[model samples]
Target: MSLTFDGTVLVPVADPDDGERTAAALAPYLSPSSTVLVVNVIEKAGGAPDKASVEQREEYAREIFERARGPLAERAGSVETAVLFGTDVVETIFEAAVDRNADAVVFEPREGRRFVELLTGDVARRLVKEARVPVVALPEDDG
Candidate 1:
């Protein structure tokens, strides 16, 4: 079967700038009838200090989505936003993709050296390995 982004696409956003870049990267794959769901996950770590409340995280997610919307509007049929609370970010992303019935999950690889990726365990790599649907990893920006 040919690869297609004709259905809903679940895109996980970390911040506004990253969201904008990811949206720009996804432009080529999107069709006029595609719906993009941009999501941000507020990682809940037990006993973590200075963690933002759910409401605060949601607000931040909204801002990121708003910024992303402008660029994605020209590419997709509709763009929506979501904020997810979870301890496991990778799991949350996968769950969201399944729950949304996404045809694909698009995201940029984490910015860091190979050592950093090895230390932190790349989420993008994990997603590609475990996601039930296709995972589209965009290239890192050179600029």
Candidate 2:
């Protein structure tokens, strides 16, 4: 199918390295007129004690955005970042897409072994299966 980047795109990243890699993968599809929304979800423990302070998590999210900003800025008209909080990562990503009025949810799938993916609930699989908006999984950049 043909993918257009004339509208806003929501990209959910796992960490700093993933942010950079995903940015590279997505850059080719974007234009100077496209708006890119980069997000990192900080998983909350539902009502239990949190793994880290909110401040710490927000700071890490900033790092993830920083890693991605340069590459995306080179191609997109604008690059924006958000730190989302939710018990469910996939759900939060979808919610952000809808809330931001994103044209599509685009990402570079994270790498993991089958066992690890199963144990971790396989977020990439769920993202493709559960997204309400169009989702694009771009191939990793060779460089």
Candidate 3:
């Protein structure tokens, strides 16, 4: 039997080709009738990035997810979207995964080398070691 899962996808852009590919891969494991929650997390501004900062960033993130939703809905059976903000990215993402009971998390790594890998230190690798659920790291496009 296929397990019901809440998909927590952390995306930077809505309608991004890479994000769509990742979602497509994830779809194979999902039930045709399963539901998914796509979460777009916005980094808190330098300071607190309080209510207003949060709102602005979250709104931007929301737009990205909103844009991605159409493709996600087409690829996956059903989908939902959310905008989240936090000072700590790792903590926020991990918490969201647990809170949503996500079967897996698909995200683009902020690289520290070569390109995307140079900025982020293998977040997907770290998550794989720490996350209770599976984590899929999508390849970053050079273009």
Candidate 4:
């Protein structure tokens, strides 16, 4: 069956470059009526000190959104951005999908070494395995 991109889609980006690539990959599937909700999760330390200040992280999230919005706007009816705070990145994305009543969760997996992915509990794997809503991993945009 073909997937429909007529409703709201929740997209999680790891950084500015990820945002740009994801938007490019996802754009082809979206129609002019689709709504893309792009989000960046600020991974909290769960009681310990955070890595970056909240302000800095928020600014970074804005940068990610800005990079993603242009491409998404060309295909989607509207593009919206959110900064999410959570100890578990995948869980935060799932929660956002439920909260937003999203039709699906879309993303382009970030590149990482095998050891690093193993150590960090590979978010892309977890997102697909434990998804609350449908999760679509768009292929990387070579163009």
Looking at model 4, residue 37 earns an lDDT score of 95
In terms of lDDT, model 3 sits at 0.59
Q: Write the per-residue lDDT of candidate 2 for residues 1-143, one digit (tens) a residue.
A: 76659899999999999999999888888988899999999999999999899999999999999999978877899999999999999999999999999999998987799999999899999999997999989976676
Q: Model 1 over residues 33-110: C-alpha lDDT tens digits?
A: 899999998898856863777778888888898888988898888898888877888899889889888888889875
1 versus 2: better lDDT goes to: 2
Q: Which segments of model 1 are wrong by more than 4 Å?
A: 1-4, 47-50, 140-143
lDDT of 4 by residue, 1-98 (tens): 56559999999999999999899889888988899999999999999999899999999999999999888877899899999999999999999999
Model 3 over residues 22-140: C-alpha lDDT tens digits?
Answer: 45545555555566677655667557435565556666665566556665675565787777666656667778877877666666554345566446544556666777567766555
- Each prediction's Cα lDDT score? 0.84, 0.92, 0.59, 0.92
Q: For residue 14, give model 4's deviation from the true position in Å.
A: 0.7
Worst 10 residues of 1 by lDDT: 46-55
Query: What residue runs in model 4 are displaced by over 4 Å at the alpha carbon?
Result: 1-4
TM-score of each: 0.86, 0.95, 0.64, 0.95
Model 2 CA RMSD to the hidden true structure, in angstroms: 1.3
Selected candidate, larger lDDT, 1 vs 4: 4
- Go through the candidates in order and give the clash count of each: 0, 0, 11, 0
- Relative to the true structure, candidate 2 reaches a TM of 0.95
Q: List candidate 2 segments past 4 Å from native.
A: none
